[model samples]
Target chain A: MTLLEDILLLGLIVTAVAAPLCKRLMATVIVYMSFGLLMAVLWVLLESPDLAVTEAAVGVGVTTILFFLTLRRIHELKGTKDE
Target chain B: MSKKESAWTRFAAWVNGEHEPAESRLFSMGMGPRKERRPEITLPKREEKQRLHGFLSWYPVASAVIGVILVGILLATVLAMPSFGQVENPTNNEVPAHYLQHTREETGASNAVAGMILNYRGFDTFGESCVLFLAVSCVFILLLRDENNTSQKDLEQAQRREQRRKRRQDVILQEAARLLSPFILLFGAYMLLGGHHSPGGGFSGGAVLGGALILYASAFGQDAIRRFFNEKVYNTVRVIGLMLYAVLFGYYIFTGANGLENHIPLDYGGLILPIDIAVGLVVACTMYGFYAMFTRGEL
Candidate 1:
């Protein structure tokens, strides 16, 4: 990998690990989004445009929306003291 | 040494074409080279094993060490891989060439990937359709609330709260969603129906459709879309999509692709467009259903 690719990959790994470990639920969700974006970039770097498209669509788009929807539902019920 | 030869042989595993089903392998092959028993080691008693396990689990340092070792091994494997787009790479072989060269002529689809999914590996696409159908079913079963079990008073309270919540949501966002929703659905349809000649296919088009539906529902409230595409209507669409794919394949099996006399009888030669739409429908429903059931706990 080039220096740029290597740095991006390291950032990707950090985001992946940090997502679950993040204290705040919202922060965790944002970190997961960051991880997905990074993964899409990595897929592009690996010369798999189709995979990059899929990762962006499903991983970043649909999944993040799902997470946000769930979070909203939780906020509706619990009145958000922020988990 | 023979060990080196054996290692090289094992490394080129795909060259051996070990593509048989698991059951067939177990029955016919009789474990082949693995028939030789592994060296036996005596097992400790349960109490002793538990004590040892507890002792090992006491230190997080051991876990860290194991993780580092695993990373190191994986890094080595990555480093040893051939450079991307190299001529000598195993993936640079004949199979991809065959697909790329003959895809248009063989399948009537200009897009190689689309042709491959809907033609060459058509059955795999059929399986994917079923999987998407099953996914929606699972989510429905898990999240759909049992209406009869809930008290009438509780239901009224929930409905009142939902309406209050809906009123509180931003109208500007809803207006924007309203403006954009039709365009989104139109684009998704174009993607799905025109997939054979373009980059977009069922998966991407379905994702777009799902996004459009979600956007529309969020903007107009579930009641708006629900009026037209209620649960019964959505279920029918989903089932029809899956059934068409299944029936298409069944017809292919029964009469063959070119019909009984091995010649094109009617204009029903390529099923790529229909199959793509079918898969797209299932996927779109899956995404929409999961959202509906999860967020509202019913659909």
Candidate 2:
């Protein structure tokens, strides 16, 4: 395999490991987002521009925003619990 | 030592006179504190229990039948492997290749993806966009409940009670959001219109616009946003968008032209107006509906 492919594979492995290892829920979500971003890059490399665009937009952009929003809501509920 | 011997003699006399020696020993052992007596084992008294046991005895038989069937399937798959491998890959070498070669001149679009989506498969795109609209409408209906008694009233009451108890902070962030919302909406529209030739499209643009509105609502209040663009207005726009798509497709069919045929008069344009407009409207409504549901925490 090419050096670039090997490097990307290593990065993906790290992301996979780190996602579960992250303690905070928000940090875990960020790691998952990075995983998705990497997958988009992989899709582009595989010569599927349409899929890449979709992954970047729906997977990374909209879904990440949704996750962040939900996380914030969870944080608010946690605050209420603390009170 | 004499008292202990006397007690043992008395116990031996009681055991010998009252019961069998084995029974007497068992009783003594059972009464000892170090161990507890086991309950007497009893046979099933109910007919139902006997029937259940009979039924359970067939479980192994059923498992054996399933296992045999699975083995048969596995053998069949193994035997069929060569035939499956020998099956020809269906080729569209003649028509699709010719179509691909002729597409650029016919569609007048630089991007093959855009041409394929907007021109070749326009009907499917229209249907998909309509599905999005339908989904958002259903979500809206499910979330909003009866209009006569809206959730806004409860929110208003809560706000009033909070205001009565304490002074609310004058947030500058809210004020800035309110100011920026219109520009965001305009940019979203531009993205929708320029989608055929540019990077941005209906879905992205609509989401951005809807997000901007959500920001405004959160900053000011739901009631404030509702005053300008209420449920009725959104519903109307959604219906209008769907109707426009239907009309466009209907026109194409009636005129004996294929659906998604570029009828729009633009120099070097591949976009049909109906698709762009329909997608834009659907995206906008969907995004808005999602935002409304999300902010209200219904989903």
Candidate 3:
């Protein structure tokens, strides 16, 4: 791979590591979103635009929203427990 | 100066300290906390576990050793891989070459991936569709609210939500969605229909459509969505899509393979379009269904 591709892969790896290391779950979700975006770019670089499109649309868009919604529900559960 | 430019100029000047923020002008705010911070609720007595399990556990060291060994094995496997894009590699063998060579003539799709998913390896794609459907079904079974089980607590929660609903900023979002929804829907349709010729298909296009519905519901409220797409409608659409794939494929198995009885003089691409649409519908429903079920237990 070229230097650019190597850098992209490195960034992808860093994001994957950083996501689980994040204390706040929401921060982890944001890191995961960037990871998805990076993977999509890698797919494009590999010349599979179809997989890139699916990764961007489904992995980033739908999955992120679902995670956010689940996070909200978790907070609600915690609130109920406190009350 | 142009109106938009002047607006930006004023914003820049304010940020540059030409003007104080509006809140500062309105009220004198303090730098310190206004109230004592409440202690957050934490897991009760995790320190007890340290005593029970011992302070200096050997698990971490053992895990690290195992992890290193596993990583070494993984690295060895990676090093064993043939160099990228090498023609002599096993991956660049006959089967893929045949697929690439005759995809146009046999499958009639310009996009090889699309043809592969919809035509050649269609059963695997069907299984994936079933998996998504299964995910939705599992979500429904676990999280769906029972109509008859209305408690006093739920009633109170509903009332509290009603009070909160008044403060929701819907007008601006509604206006924006009105401007964008049509284009988003059109793009989704393009992705679905042009999938055969290009770099899109059922899953991606369905996600786009589902995302649009999510935006619309968020802007216009659940009741607005319920006016048309209720629980029954939602269930019916997805089930129909799943059933269509199952039934058609089963029929094709008996009628298609057997030459003794020929039904449709076969265009190889005949079932691909319908199957693609079926997968698209199921996927779109799964996406939207997950959002709806998770956010509000009611459909």
Among the numbered candidates, top DockQ falls to: 3
lDDT of 2 by residue, B50-147 (tens): 87788899987998899789989999998866543233524534656655675566555444555566666767777778788878767666665443
lDDT (tens digit, per residue) of candidate 1 on B1-299: 89998766665653344444335655364644647687886677897789888887876778789989999999999999997778899999898998898776666678878888876788888888888889889877666777544678767866986787677987887889979889989988988888888767788888889988988887777888888989899999999989987887676656664223323222232666887898889888988998888767666
Instruction: State the TM-score of candidate 2 restricted to chain B.
Output: 0.55
Task: Give the alpha carbon lDDT tens digit for every residue of A5-80 in model 1.
Answer: 9999899889978987888788898899999999989988887655776677678878988988888767842464
Report, for all candidates in order, the number of backbone clashes: 0, 0, 0
- TM, chain A, every candidate: 0.86, 0.83, 0.87
lDDT of each: 0.78, 0.66, 0.80
User: lDDT per residue, candidate 2, A1-83, as tens digits?
Assistant: 46776777788889988998888877887898998898888877777655665566566755666676677556632442312
- Name the 10 consecutive residues with the lowest summed lDDT in model 1 chain B: B258-267
- Best of the candidates, lDDT: 3
* Ranking 1 against 2 by lDDT, winner: 1
For model 1, report DockQ: 0.45
| Distance from true location, Cα of B81 in model 1, Å | 3.1
Looking at model 2, the pairs that clash are: none
Q: Which 10 residues in a row give candidate 2 chain B its minimum summed lDDT?
A: B83-92
Q: Candidate 2 overall Cα lDDT vs. reference?
A: 0.66
In model 1, what are the clashing residue pairs, if there are any? Answer: none
Model 3 has a DockQ score of 0.66
